[model samples]
Target: MTEILGLYNYWIVIFLMMTGFYIVIARENLIKTIIGLNIFQTSVFLLYITMGKVTHGTAPILKASHGGESHGVEHGVEHGAEHGHELHAAAEGHVDLGVDAVKEVYSNPIPSVLMLTAIVVGIATTALALALVVRIREEYGTIEEDEILEMDRNS
Candidate 1:
């Protein structure tokens, strides 16, 4: 039950995705189809953002030392020592290069950045689609797919 509850965001994403898909497939109106596409896009964005989250995580920001001497290494070493651990090299057989192991857990920023780009692209695509729909309405006096098909058949 706890495991299922923890995946609430995934459930929401699936629901929105199916709803959007149904709207696009079952509706005949051009406007409704565009709205459905937008819904689908939103669900994808939500999924990416949700996947990028980490438990008890923070933004990946490195704090610089006020003085030019220590360079934050002392702080890392002190933190590790406080936790009853020693900072070690990341790999075996490699010399300890004095690099501090950052114990902070940080959420990945890539998914959010990619989603932002996708949102801009989605908005541009939707605008183009709506403009095309308007032109279709002007030409056929209707935006219904069935009506448009009937007109095409009669012509």
Candidate 2:
């Protein structure tokens, strides 16, 4: 059931992406297409945030107190206070913290990097599209693609 929930969330993200794609493809207005593109980008961002949510994983920073006082080797033991927490690098390739198993899961950095790139791309596309819209407005005094087409026909 938990797996199903995760799958449902993923499906929702995919649905958002597809809806945005459809809107872009089916709409004749350039501004509407740009909106759809933004929607598509937002769906991808949602997926990234959802996947990056770690239930118990701490920050990647290894502070002096949070680790061992001697050699900084984390055996994954929870001390009386949160100050003495050490990172346990399991020998079997799995660290068990006896409480939250999520801390053992390796953090994925790819999605984060990809999301950064995607954001930049989305911004660039939006800027370019807006510039084109401005030019179209100046040329024809209207933003509707169909109206522009009619003007062309009349000309």
Candidate that scores best on lDDT: 1
Model 2 lDDT, residue 23, Cα: 84
TM-score of each: 0.71, 0.65
By TM-score, the best candidate is: 1
Q: For candidate 2, lDDT tens digit of each residue in 1-155?
A: 99887588889999999999998998778999999999999898889966876656544344444343323223222331244333223322222222233334435656777888999999999999999999999999999988999999999
| Candidate 2: regions farther than 4 A off | 1-3, 49-55, 58-106
* Number of colliding residue pairs in model 1: 0
CA lDDT scores, all candidates in order: 0.78, 0.72
Weakest 10 consecutive residues, lDDT, candidate 2?
72-81
